[model samples]
Target: MTLLRGLVLLSLCLASGQSAGDQPAPAGSQNAPCPLLSVNDPVQRDRLLYHTCYLSQPTDLGDWRQITPAQLPAQLKWQASNGEQLAFPRSQLEYWIRLNLKNDGPTPGFWYLALDYAPVDYVSFTLHRANGSSVIETGDQRPFDARGIDYRYYLVPISLNAGEAATLYLRLSSQGALNLPLSLLTPDELVAQSNTLTLTHGLFYGALIIFALFNLLLFISSGTRYYFFNAFYMASLGLFLFAMGGFAYQHLWPGSPWLANTAVPLSMALCALAINLFGRSFLQVRRQSPLTSRLMTAQTGIACGLLVLALALPYNHAIAIITVAALALICSLFFIGVIRWRQGHSHAKWYVLSWSLMVLGTLTYALAAFGYIPDFLQQEMIMQSAIGGQVLLLNYAIVQRWRDMQKRLWLAENRAKMRLEREVAERTTQLQDAMRDLEAANQRLEALSTRDSLTGLHNRRYLDGRLTELIREAHRHLRPLALVVLDADHFKRINDHYGHAVGDLCLRHIADELKHAVHRPQDVVARFGGEEFALLLPDTDLAGAQRVTNQFLQRLASCPAGQREGLHIPLTLSAGVALLQADETQAQLFERADSALYRAKAGGRNQLVVAGNTPAPVGTATNRNRE
Candidate 1:
């Protein structure tokens, strides 16, 4: 690489008539004669025209035929170039560069003269050899096919016979910065360099397109305004870079020179507008400071106006205006990001960092264009690198914003759930109280339905129910059950002599005595009707039934039946008992007991009779039980 660089420097020194050991001529030398560039060695395939001479003209000079080499020496004064490239600020003047070539070898030379810059408006190449003169004109101002060689940059072929010399003149005109980095190469070197450049540009543009599509998908799914604006910004930045780098002119609108020229300024304006919108939304500028928000709005409006004027104004004027507007937009976005970050906006720190990178790159490129700074790096490469970094940072900021939102939503849901639980607990307590009160009322109704109101004992209905249940138990478990039916003896006579009220009192007195005799919890005592009573006993045999009736008769004989208002009324009861037999139904058992009671009443006033047995005197039953 060092040897190659030395060779390049030697060739440049030879073009200015200086050897490797000699000092370079001064920059003010305009009258020195230009040296003949010798293509003598076939091994030396590449050369750079670093020390070319140039003549400036204010307007179009009629034709190339009017400026032959013989007349040009007296008609114009050519100035020597100071560096490898010829750089000038944007201008309307035309520049003419001169190179004198000679093939001093035995073989003829076939070489390509090329210009690396693409945005020059018009370039005309004129070659005058010993054989004939040729002229070729092509630039972004002309259709792409108008070029003699089909390539992105300006390239033309030149040939010189052995021992023959040629004079070549190039005319350049543009409405943008004029940078001429001219080179002469063999066919092999041209092809190699073109391939290298194509690969580099492909990777750069591919990265920009990927970022653009990725942000577009995010915007569609999330419906975030900032994401939409970010996608638009990336797309416009890519398009502007494409046009500025000549890719759009070569590939997109090669047939239309006007479109090629207009795309640069228009795309740049769109980029400015999109960035302003993205920054405003990402930072929530309106919520933070209304004044800053309005300023961004105005900047967007200016960018939109520039978009319309880019086609209407001259290319130089439109590009200049758009460049200034874009710089202002970037700076303002950076300023707003700083303000928001200081105010505690969560996403604004990333915004500030990203815009800071963009602002640095854009400022450097702009300063180079306006001739205020050296072009240390290629403007396109610097901007592309900065934009890639900014895109990644901003995407991260959006992700952080989404996470914050999700957290807030989760917190709100938890609070609502806690409130609902409190309400549910209160409702549950109220329902428990209501259920407790309902249970108490149901217990009272149950007591009224099953108990006799007058005797405070099981009524006839309860007796019937118990009788059926006890009969089922006796059949299933082989247990004895007894039922007794009894009637109040001489009850009608008491009512006739002492009044009905006294008779009721005597019946109650008889019921009290019967209740006291049957003290077992398994026994059920009930009033059968007026002046009649029944007893249901579970697990009781015939002998047990006889004993219970005898005891009740003995107790009643010792006590007065009824006493009211100092009047006494006598009462006696005749009872019959039946034991539950095998396979006995409730109706059959009740019929047998009623039959025994009827017999007891027929035999005498008061006696106990057992079903399937003869009647026994109440006194005899009591005495037999005692013995």
Candidate 2:
């Protein structure tokens, strides 16, 4: 099928070539002198080629024979140029150009006829002089080593003696656009032109190489697929540009004309693939808009198909397919950029701008090729400049994307940190509250352990601890401290007669009486155990201690237990009081008070006795007086 198509396409080209060949010259232009080109010692810089050349195409499609220069005046019909490059559609048609030159100076004329367009398959120059005629032929179809001058374009050397007039014949044939833009240049002008073209190409290709390497480095360092895709795009695009400008043929694969003819289509196909990959990755279309992603993927398949066809098919057919695919690819990518931009992709705007310039440049060159517009700038130059701008702009876009990604990552980390801090702060507050509650519970437990359950007074444990503290304080300050120990006069009898419940009531009454008698903040009153009680007084001497003990006994005698409840149960307390002496321990003082309480019980049970035999009166119900 592919071969059949190639054959049909070749037939069409030949048909078109034949039709163009039959086009008539402008009226009365036949027999007119070939436009005369006057050359001086130095060629005029501003004399355009269109002003001096006449073009002619053979009318015989079947006549494959070459014309001789001697036969030219009668056999060929020349048409004046329209003052611009003569453009025709893609064809393998032959075009003949005639130029009449006159050297108008004493010095010989040395000129170079330059064909700036690069893809011409074959070009032949025949110089007809008065003495003889010579021909030089060279083009991309020939090896680069075969050229007389080592240059990318076809340059044919022309010379004339002073005042000599001659006619030159040029024959060109190509399978692509036959846009003949011919120029005559002296050696100096050609050098200057070469310099200008070199600088322009250097800057354009340099920017592309730089962008490719920069993105490739980014991909290597970061492992980002987007950077890799961008690098691939730039590299492929650069290759396409090089092949399009004929640099690949001139410098890269000069001996392989097959490779040279296939290079443009192959590079273009690769560029298409790269564009799809880069567009999809850059726009994040897969994640953001799946449909758009699928469209780009389909375009990628088309590019792959183009690649296969470029290798398998002939150059003209492959190039025709590549051209249509490239147009569709560029327009589709531009629309994808617009779609992604609308969907809020960050780099989409840059994508759109880059493709917009590319589309403009492409259309400009295409229009000039089809004769819709004048070729103001060389089509290659316009396209190269546009692509250069696109590369730089997209590089900026990639950098911007990197910065934006960094900013987003930083913001996410900061937000996570703030959330963690808030959690920590809340947990800290909760822990502090829990600690306070625990402390309070511990204090309650301590209180429970140290209080008398029945009497609600400090128990013997508390009395012992307080006595030790007060004794130490007294020794340190040389202040007197007092200890009193007392017991219910007949606690056992009360428990036996009225039951243990009433006995508990009586003990509570006695505790109340003791509390009333000792009204100092520094006094410690406690149930000493069983029915015994003790009082700890700080800063109280022997006399003061005796007085407090006596008063407590009297109060106990007056307020008998069960009186409020109408039960006649009498209650009294017998106590022993001891003052803290110099160098006395709490154990010794407690033993002395306990011995004094035993004496009081022995002396008839209702009296107060002090330690060291200091005795108080018995407060019996009969006498109720002190002894």
Candidate 3:
């Protein structure tokens, strides 16, 4: 690289002919004789003379003169190698030139002459009118050229007339100097070249900056690492383009030569890294699918190779690095499509088409840059086609990616809504089941409140309520109503002797005996208290009640007291009977029956007591008897 730079510097120094301090003169030089003529006629003659003098430098060194129309007849005797004598009519001549020049060296500078003519004469010179307007002649000489020799040449402004001939001399002073040709340009062409370069570069850079900003905004809005990578990639591509020796940087930042050089490799490296990272994220290459992983590895290798090449070569290698990177990017896009296809990503088709168009554009640019096409074709046609197509493809890719993201977001939202609804439905079902269980438990609690738990019989609350209706019915019909209260004797003793299990059995036996002894449907048997029971008879007299109580007593006496492994013990029950009295409340009747039960207990155990024809007092003992 240092050798190349030194060689370039040597070439520049040799061509410039100085140590950069001297200004070289412009390339051409010319000499010619003066003429006498009306300035107006000479202007027309000189205009034609300059038209041919612009072609080349010739070898003859003298015999160049400008003449007026009056001298045209005498000058017509001159003949040369072509065997053609100069001829002029007296009225046709205005101005003319006889010229000779040495073509031994390079083309010479511009020369001019003012000439007059009379009558008729015609003179011609060879010079090309490169650019600018031709005007009528005046007395003063203007710049022109007599053309010949190997190097390039041009004609400056010169004038001639109709009645005279002008003689101009052309000289050659240097070799290999080319003229700054402007033969093809018009006024509008000159203006366009001067102005459009800046405007074109401005628009290019402006578009690049806008695209970079758009990617940056996407990165910030989405918080996706891929978007960030794309942003960096685009920015680096913009910087790389600016760093290249293009009209954009030439017109916009011409003074920043150091920045220009640094941007080359730096942007190359950054772009390579950005593209590598973007590929990894965009293709989900780390998911360990074999083909995707292999493709990613290959892309990484290519990117690394590009970086190494950029670092090792001269800075101008930025162009090669960018080209290689573009190729790698194209390949990566293809592999991404493959991965997406394998993974069942529906949007890959659009992405693939978009990148394919971009790759085509990039390949076109690459071909043009390498001089595979004409300069006019590359600059005016291929470049525009490539850039325009690539931009459209990039926009298409952006829209496709946006639509894919929107679809993913919509699916995620739908899934979340479904999950929430499912949870709500499940909770509602659970609440309904819980309410049903609670209602069942409430019904069980109500049943337990009125019934006896131990023997499954009506409790004291039932007995008390039924006894009142029995007494009222008996009083209305003047019939008999009777009550019997019974107790299991020696129940606590049974519990102490054989455990509470046998004591519970003893109570159950006594309850069974009492239920069996009550034969009437109107009679209700109930557990009155811990070891006590009651029987109410709605249509029975006191005698009938006494007889039923005695029967219950006998049945209890016959029941087994306890059973332990099939061994039996004797168990007995005691009872008291009462007849319903007129004007007596049910509580009074129950008190009398309770008193009779105690009397039976007092007269020895396992016996029945009947209420006698005595006033039923609260604490009086009734008649007692053993059954």
Candidate 4:
């Protein structure tokens, strides 16, 4: 088991391309003095001082320390070969030595001074130290450009005993200025470059906050899980980037170096979690092909393994593994997005493009970190370009998603409108059909109420309507209007002598005679009831009405019904005629006509009577000679 574990550790170290050792020097050389001075320049030669410098002041004397400086010669002379050193007793403080070089050459040339320290064992190198401090150191080492050349530096702070001795090497050469050219930088340029990284980190965090708030609002409004996942993933990615770049340690909690050291593993874990969640949301990885899902799972597992390795290894090894794993994870995400795009998910196309750009930027930075690219191309400018491109691509993808959602919503709204219109049209058509049917039913009811079924003549309701109209016309046009009321004499005796069917035939015959008597189109004849009928005439005087009524009675008396059981029966009618008064309604006109009818019946069964002009009922004896 031990051997297997060793092999696994070795494999991880090899995979990450990191050295496993933590101690800077070899074994059995624990007390050897640190060499701080070296000379490689020929243009200038001087003896430079080597000492443990203290930068603490009297602001707070409890955490302060002091140290003395020592000098060495330009060359390794016999007397100056024994190097000098100085140290301070305090443990947690930041200090640096000011190495003074005397120029031996006549012309001013470049000289190099280097300060070296062991790997950091504590959280931070504070200019002042306190017990409850929050300062921490991130294991991010990079070359700094002072003016025109690069200067390699370390920020790790350490303390030595009161009499500890260390050697310093001084090198003076014309090429030294080409390597460390702090004197060449303008003050503005120095400040700008110094805080460029810090500003970039701040902008990244600000973007993360904006994206998180935006997605949080979306989640609240739409209740979609995708927005939730995007918020979490974006926030995690921002934190991981901040931690990996060591900006979190530099400005946030500079006192806790142990916390800074843990950033690598913690960032890796968050990165893994972010990828896992993003895959599920953006790619729908679980529902994709089984092989593809397995591949995604494997990638997620690799990210998890990287975090575990970071925790188990030293700081340097952890950082190396995290960087390599981040690259691998980015590559995997890019390819997965490409695959989804090919499978007809158009949404994945934007994701693929975004990831491709990110992968290119990551590879560029990786090449720069591994010394495969030039320092100038790998510095602040390139870093900004890469990160800026990624942010722009992500913004474009978000905009594209928004546009697609809007289009879908518009289409759904249009479809609903068309569906509602169709439903309304159908309902309107049904209502129109129902209205037509109701009109037809009302006409049938009117016909049944106003027409006689036996003779097909207008019934009593028809007489009532026409009489009122005739009376109105008489008043309006100053013309005479007359109404005649008639009855079939002995209609009940006819129904008893012959069957009621024959009696109905006799009434029908009397109705035909009354219609024939009325020759003017303005006259109307109707069956008022059983054996009774009415005639209305407009523009007809009382004499004309009396003539028409007497003719109707004679015609009815002469009408013969052919043999019923070899017997013939004669039909006769009694009628009464009246002129409409100026102010008379149809009801009053009918009453006057009916009173004349009663007088006609009293004189004899077959006779005609004229209202208002008749002294007594005139018998039909006058019209009987003409028939």
Candidate 3 lDDT, 529-561, residue by residue in tens: 989888887666666667777766676666675
For model 4, what is the error of residue 409's alpha carbon versus the real structure, in angstroms, after optimal superposition?
A: 6.1
All candidates: CA RMSD (Å) = 26.0, 24.5, 31.9, 26.7
By TM-score, how accurate is candidate 2?
0.62
Q: After superposition, how far is residue 287 of candidate 3 from its true place, in Å?
A: 4.7
TM-score of 1: 0.60
Arranged by TM-score with the best first, the candidates are 2, 1, 4, 3
TM-score, structure 4 vs. true: 0.42
Q: How far out, in Å, is residue 117 in model 2?
A: 0.5
Kindly list the per-residue Cα lDDT of model 1 for residues 129-207, writing each as its tens digit: 8778898878888998888676777888988888899888887778766766577887787889888878878887787
- Candidate 2, residues 1-627: lDDT per residue as tens digits? 332343344334333545333342223344455556776633342455444455555556444236655555455556666355566556556777778778887888788988766667777788888999888877668777666887777788888899998888887776665666677888888999999999999988887888899889999998988899989988888887787677888788989877777888899899888988988888777876878888888988999999999999976567766766776688788887888778766767887888888777765665454323445247778888888778877877777777777888999999999999999989867865775689987566656556787888898778778777887877776676778899888889889989998998998888888888777777888996889888887776667778878887877787778878888788887888887666777788888999999999999988988888333212111221111
> RMSD of model 2, in Å?
24.5
- The regions of model 3 sitting more than 4 angstroms off are 1-188, 194-200, 248-269, 283-294, 297-305, 315-322, 338-346, 376-381, 423-435, 438-627
Scored by Cα lDDT, where does model 4 land?
0.54
| Residue 387, model 1, lDDT | 76
What candidate 1 gets wrong by more than 4 Å, as runs, is 1-27, 40-49, 58-75, 369-377, 407-627
Q: What's the count of clashing pairs in each model shown?
A: 0, 1, 67, 22
Which candidate has the highest TM-score of all? 2
